[model samples]
Target: MSISVPQLHAELPTGCSVDRSGFMRRVSGVQAVSPISPPRSPVPLRLSVPGRLLAGGIGLGCLVILMIAGLVVPDSRGVGTHEQLGMPACGFLSRTGIPCGTCGMTTSFSLLVRGDLPAAFRAQPFGAVAGVAAGMTVWAAGYIAITGRPVHRLFRRCSATWLVGILLGAWLISWGWKIFVVVGGLVGG
Candidate 1:
């Protein structure tokens, strides 16, 4: 079978003629035919102002919790505030005598909230990053909540797989750094 497209004829002056070529494509026993491209869907619509405000409000609430936890709890000097909060100690540390990935996170965040950057990093680099991220989120979310304007669209175009991979990679790197810090401390002190 073959498909054909209609030809167009236009009137022109003498000796000025338009040449017409047959527009047909053979469709018999095609070995390698290019697949038809699917129509692209539009970007999903973003949340409205009030909807964004609601989301931001929830984020701000989480930030508030982090802030309150930071303020009310004191840094345990890498021991973490989990015990102070009536939580069990790190099981890995208790059994294997090695710090876990999140062992000093609470202490790191608390120290960071107290404006001790070096101490925070020494406590847990990832926790310091988490504290900073929480603060930034609080600020951005508050702005979105109050003004109803979308803040930076940095990750608007990021795919879920990319985002998850980035996050996991960061987590792994941070965990490795945490282990290195802990081992260095043990060796130095």
Candidate 2:
């Protein structure tokens, strides 16, 4: 039996598939037919046209967020930067005399825009992490959109549940850190 040339798919023209006994060998830039081969490193995932469109949209969204951050001035007080956008003060802090979990996030984003990483982290750990995440997403999306390649191992190894759990854990930890900093007088305002 002989291997056939590529066949178009509803998803991608180069979409991968494996037959029983796994005779297919996907090579760099193209798939090929070969004898049974030893195990190799994971192959990068090829993006479908829709996937590329989504990636472009995601990159654009992240860039828009960063641009908005650049427009805002980081508050020296470490919080209340959202007020500059005509938002009211934190009602939780005002009524309960305690900073909310997300307090200082806006200021952190503003500091990130100014390239003051230390100040951004100081303002809000979550916000700093979020800024970095957004930046990375923009980079990854651009790469995927341009090259039609995505880090396959990452997506293959992690499930949706696992990703959600990690995000939840990080959020909780950041919120706790914020509360500690404010209560310990380490944070100003």
Candidate 3:
């Protein structure tokens, strides 16, 4: 396979210089955005079974931890199940008198695991979405672990900016809903 790069004249613009490969030339005047450079595969061209299993195992382990936390903790009206585990309250919430973006995520996950969809949505819509994703990841990772194959190439092809945008959008939307509910409740009561 060959990649074609556009050619420029020998006497290029003032700040343009050719790279070692003589394919890409960088111009000083131009700015490039390199937010998410695609990671070069460390694994050889031929996929290794152990590498696939290792990746799958790591993903499965994270999902298991999340599911266990959900199972053990009881979902409550507010956030800070972490406090129940002897952690401090959310400093942001304490100072601002408002919940932060991740305030109710644990409770939402717990409600989701307990099959309480409405409460999960009320707590944080993103949590329900994340819970669903965690479940799917566990299933997919389990399959890859058993079959010794990976399906990560598709994810690798996706743009990092697009994925980040989707996540931030979800969080913003969930935060807006939480604010609206809190304000509405204050007004009603």
Can you write out model 1's per-residue Cα lDDT over 1-189, one digit (the tens) per residue? 333445543423233333345445444454554569998756534568778868687777868767765765654447557688778988987787667878778887777888988877777777778888888888878766666666656777989899789877877777777677666664211
lDDT of candidate 3 over 1-189, digit per residue (tens): 223355655655454566656654556567545468889978625337887677687777868757665755743644675665567888887887677888777777777788887777887788778877887788777766766666776598789999999999999998887666555653210
For model 3 the TM-score comes to: 0.65
Task: Report clashes for each candidate as comma-separated counts.
Answer: 0, 0, 0
User: Which candidate wins on TM-score?
Assistant: 2
Candidate 3 lDDT score relative to the true structure: 0.70
> How well does model 1 score by local distance difference test?
0.69
Which candidate number has the best lDDT? 2
TM-score (all chains, Cα) for each model = 0.66, 0.69, 0.65
lDDT of 3 at 58: 71
**TM-score of candidate 2 on Cα atoms, chains taken together:** 0.69
How many Å off is the CA of 94 in candidate 2? Answer: 1.8
Model 1 segments more than 4 A misplaced: 1-50, 72-76, 157-159, 183-189
Candidate 2 C-alpha error for residue 49, in Å: 2.5
Among residues 3 or more apart in sequence or in different chains, the pairs in candidate 3 whose N, CA or C atoms overlap within 3 Å are: none
